[model samples]
Target: MLFYLTTLNLARFLKEDPPFIGEDEIDVQTQQAIDAWKHAEFLCRNYLLNGLSDTLYGVYSVKKTAKELWNSLDHKYKAEDAGAKKFLVGQFLNFKMVDSKNVISQVQELQLIIHGIHAEGMVLSESFQVGAIIEKLPPAWKDFKNYLKHKRKEMSVEDLILRLRVEEDNQGNEKRTLNPNAAKANLMEHDRGSKGKNPKHKQGPKLGPKGGIAKKPKFQGKCFNCGKMGHKSSE
Candidate 1:
């Protein structure tokens, strides 16, 4: 809404205007005054309809003139706007990475929020932003945080963010190098666990060398079946 007004050079009309008196009641007014008033009315009606809520539309709908609606909204909402800016400042101050996001991502998010804080009227210096971001680093990042703090030169917000990205990447490579064996062990353990529930199958009885029963030995001149000495007996 502000941008719209700014582009058209009509922002000042909303913030400042001669005490609006009825056209008929005014003793003397210039042609410029009349034109400004007409444009403000036309733009304000459109702004309220398109930009604001139906509730606000209803609130301003009853006003007989656009100037009255503009003034009324400014008086009522501008005072309430203070709380929103305060909340933004609080968020900027209490920003913490926790463990939910990567270090570089958290820092980038913090940069966006800091920019928003500046837009909301709390301008912070580049050095201050850089220092605040370092301070808010999670406990696991103590070494990097201290390294950033102990730097002799003041750094811009972008510089600090770039350095943080490089540091995070270096740390990731180091972890991969030192723990490759541990990672392999974990994969092996998981594979073993996947088959842990089933029992092993037992082997069946061994097969003979030929696909037939073994031949029995016979005694000299003795019946093999009867085991008696003499002629072989037929059964």
Candidate 2:
């Protein structure tokens, strides 16, 4: 708002007193100057009031001069903005990334805190924001953090976020690849345990080496009825 006023050349009315006309002795140029000053003052004051909310408009509309309204607003909101700035700074300093949460989501949260700080009139460089994000990464990302820190090229916040997203995706793919192998190993171990716990039942009669049932040997000696060397009477 102040910047806009400065651009319009009306900001002087906020700092300068209104022009005075002497009784019965004013030059045409002096009268013109006074009239111009009054017009500018009116514009400046109306602009300020129009920018306010309905509640604030009603509250501050009683101020007759642009300078008074400007000072009152500055006095009120400046202190509030200062307190908000400190809170935002604290939030930024205390932000930490955790392994259980998505890194991109956490980065976004940090970005919001940065935005709040900027809105409160505190400016942070892109490189500083990038460094802060790296420092706040979870313990699992220590090696990656070191790698980023050792790089010679400086990165903007956007570039840093892109790099982090790629790294996170790679890590996710690796974990996905390892999970199936771990599950397979666990399944095999479980199967072996089940087999050990319940041994197989005893098998049926043994078969011949060729996997066929063996026939009984013929009677070599004479049978009781025939008494012959190799024949039985019944046969």
Which lDDT values do the candidates have, in the order given?
A: 0.76, 0.89
Looking at model 1, the pairs that clash are: none
* Pairs with backbone N, CA or C atoms under 3 Å apart (clashes), candidate 2: none
Query: Residues 118-204, candidate 2, lDDT per residue (tens digit)?
Result: 887789998888889999999999999999999989899999999999999999999988787887889988998988854566866
Error of 1 at 164 (Å): 1.2
Candidate 2 ranges with C-alpha deviation above 4 Å: 1-12, 24-47, 115-121, 150-159, 181-235
Output the number of the TM-score-best candidate.
Answer: 1
TM-score against truth, every candidate: 0.63, 0.59
